[model samples]
Target: MKTSECMLCPRQCGVDRSVKFGFCGESEEIRIARAAPHMWEEPPISGTKGSGTVFFSGCNLRCIYCQNHEIAVSHLGYAVTADKLLRIFFDLQAQGVHNINLVTAGHFAHQLIPILRQAKADGLRIPILWNSSGYESADTIRMLEGLIDIYLPDFKYINPKTAKEYSNAPDYPETAKASLAEMVRQVGAPQFDSQTGLMTRGVQVRHLVLPGHAQESRQILWYLFQTYGNGIGYSIMNQYTPMPQMKDHPLLSRKVTAQEYENVIRYAKQIGIENAYTQEGEAACESFIPKFSGQPQ
Candidate 1:
């Protein structure tokens, strides 16, 4: 949990973050690009109102097809103190959102642990979701044993070559597997509100099917279904929006085709993945991406 020689992520780029930047492209200080109620997540998480989402700047993975490359890569955000983040949590809770969703926040686990502890102590009662890239260190995830109520981590890749090519993380497959195991350990079972149907505690794994990676997506789905089964929830996403950065890349320059997405969905059905969520309509469009205005909406 030391930010001085930051090892909070699997990268282990031991640079003094206070004085230098790490592979995550962030300093010791926590930066937030956006804080608002998001209605685009899974139904249980977003509900009728929305999920109070805090988009943290900086990421452990460098995904070339990232839709939020503005904040994740460019780091165009203002710094916030622990007290400010604590207040943001309570303020979002006051907005009547179903839960507090922390997006891509595994890199800031050091600062978030204490801030989350204080938020709960100050009567922040909404379910807090740790929305991460799934390229996490198991030890770091263990530090958040009692604090987080829900986990929404992405299982981006199962092949090391694909992971390295897409996100520059070769160890992503093993790292994500271990991290997910730890998460399931922390949140034992999926719990839901009787009336609202909002998720109170559990883990939901998401996989975004890439343009030409339908086979790999099937592999990931098979792995998750085989390992966790109906013990956890699944989100087979088709919203792989091609960003401006991927214009030159042949494969990533285009959106996922309808047939490709349907094939993945068919495989999920074939594998008996009942407790899952799927996207409908034109999901591979930039319109679905949220705006990072650096101010809460």
Candidate 2:
């Protein structure tokens, strides 16, 4: 998390983040696209209230079919100082949120760690969730050990060909696996509050089912069950919206059919994956992707 030389993610694209931009297309300054109560998460994280979500701009991996393409690719967000970021957390905590969720923050880890530590010292009582793309370095994750209470990372792909084609990361399968193991080691196991139904500590691995990739999705499910064995919660997401930018692309042009989603879900049950989550009908629409301008801007 140093500004002098950037090695936050596995890419290790060394550049003075303060002067030159790295692979993530980010400078030293902290940029945030959204700060609000986001309810579009798991039941434990969102509960009756919502997860205090802070969506950081830019990303380590540039997934071609990303729903948050506006911020991930174009970096459509406003700049904020460390103090301002803390205020945002306070504001959300005042709104009775379940936890402080940091989304897509792998690129800005340098600027965020201190802010998170200060927030914790200043009575930021809610559990802190590290929501990431799962293309992370074990060193970077180990640095945030106790500071992060919940690890919500996406296990995107098992096939190197698919990873290279979509995310441009050929080592996604191994990288994500090691990252998940480290995350599970830190958090131990899933723990939830009885009355609040909020997740206090755990690792929740999310996988967005892509169109024409049901076989890979099933392999990812088996990998999770075999490796972690119910130590992490599996959330199978079928909410892949075909964004406008990928209209001409090959696989990203279409929506995931009900059969595709069902095929993956059915495989999870067959493989004895009981600790999991799945989406209902009509979740592959654009209504779920929030605007980049965000609220109360």
Candidate 3:
């Protein structure tokens, strides 16, 4: 869990983070791009009040088609201490948010445990959600056992070859599998607040249906249904908007076709994954992406 020779993620880029930055382009400092309430998440997570979201800068597996490329590729956030982070949690709690959502905190999971504990001690209510890229170490997830109430992780790719070609992580599938198991073990079945319709505990697998890869998406749906059954939620995303930088790239140069999205959805029905969320028309747009430059208002 030491970032001095950072190994929190599967990358294990031992870079003595006290002196140098790791593969996540961050040192010991906690740099966050945005800290505010986000309503763009799934129904239960966003609810009516919206989830108190904090977007962290830098990422372990920055795919070629990353929607949050600005924050994922650069340091565009304010550096805050553990104490300050706890204060942010308290501030958001006062705003009457549905939950405290920690976006992409794996790189800083080493420092969050104590802060979360202290915040809860200081009367921080509401569920604690960990929104992740799913390329996490099981040990890292284990460290956050009771502290994290909900898990929102992406099951990006089922094939190692696709993972390697897209995100440069050949070990993504296996690594994510282990991480998911740990998360499920921590919170057994998916449980939601009956009155509020907010998720209290459970792991939700978010699989973005990539263009020209609907079959792979189908495969991932089948795997999730077979493995977790209806105990977990699956969000089939159609929000793969092609960024301007990818205008000349090989496969990421176009948006995910409507046919491709439908194909994936058809397969989901075949697998009986009724406990899933699917997108509708015109979801692959840049309007959904939040600005990651400074303090979000």
Candidate 4:
């Protein structure tokens, strides 16, 4: 199948990606940055083993403070056929991962459908997680209704102005709200395996507490709790690191303050949001960034 003028995401960058690359720097082919067992995800998603992570290259929203800017903005990666991607999945499965995680795959949605179908047919029994930035279109999400088993989406911003300043996308908050509603509609609530503690099917909403954005984080959590009402899982993250390019931005130049993260967590408890996960002070350390030096077959 050919890639359309590719308004797959909210970007709607009408550059005929079938012939040439769009604003995302990728064409019809699937470009991957890394394929390996990632252990740094949330407890249920990562478990005692690991999550089979396939980090796709290019992104619709290039946030200035993005940690994975190498793959997200710079497009530092190579293209691989769907067949090769399936092979990598099977290889990772053999390595004993709990689930297959597809990170930042919104731009390449059409291309991933067939690849996932083939992997499912070839004895890929683990749950498939659609991990993405919250900037998604409802129509694009509807296309993935039954294919995705777990939804791990980030609710980046509560206000459009903050989104525009940080990610150059003014519609981030609106798009994310609609897209997350669709995700919840598809996967009703968080379901887990009793013995393994691994997630089976659910929508886990992640909110990274940005420095100087504690109020925004509180609003986002309140919105999520009000909308989903314990039907969704929440992972409150505190791993915001200042990348080189963010040194000039006033808010993005430092790590999230302890008070900022604490306030959000406190708000979550006040709202009676029980199924929430949080990190401590040491989580701000840069030791979490995984080495993307390709996966062993």
Candidate 4 residue lDDT tens string, 179-293: 9999999998999999877899999999999999999999999999999889999999999988888888888899998888899999999998999989988888777887565
Evaluate all candidate structures by whole-model CA lDDT and list the values in order. Answer: 0.90, 0.89, 0.88, 0.89
- 141: Cα error in model 4, Å: 1.0
List the candidate 1 regions with Cα displacement exceeding 4 Å: 295-297
Could you tell me every candidate's TM-score relative to the true structure?
0.97, 0.97, 0.97, 0.97
- Put down candidate 2 lDDT per residue, 53-81, tens digits, no spaces: 99998888999888898889896888898
Each model's number of backbone clashes? 0, 0, 0, 0
Q: What is the lDDT of residue 189 in candidate 1?
A: 57
lDDT of 2: 0.89
Residue-by-residue lDDT tens digits, candidate 3, 118-141: 888888879999999899999999
Report lDDT (Cα) of residue 74, candidate 3: 59
Candidate 4 lands at a TM-score of 0.97
Q: Any runs in candidate 3 off by more than 4 Å, and if so which?
A: none
In terms of lDDT, model 1 sits at 0.90
Extract clashing residue pairs from model 2: none
| Ranking according to lDDT, highest score first | 1, 4, 2, 3
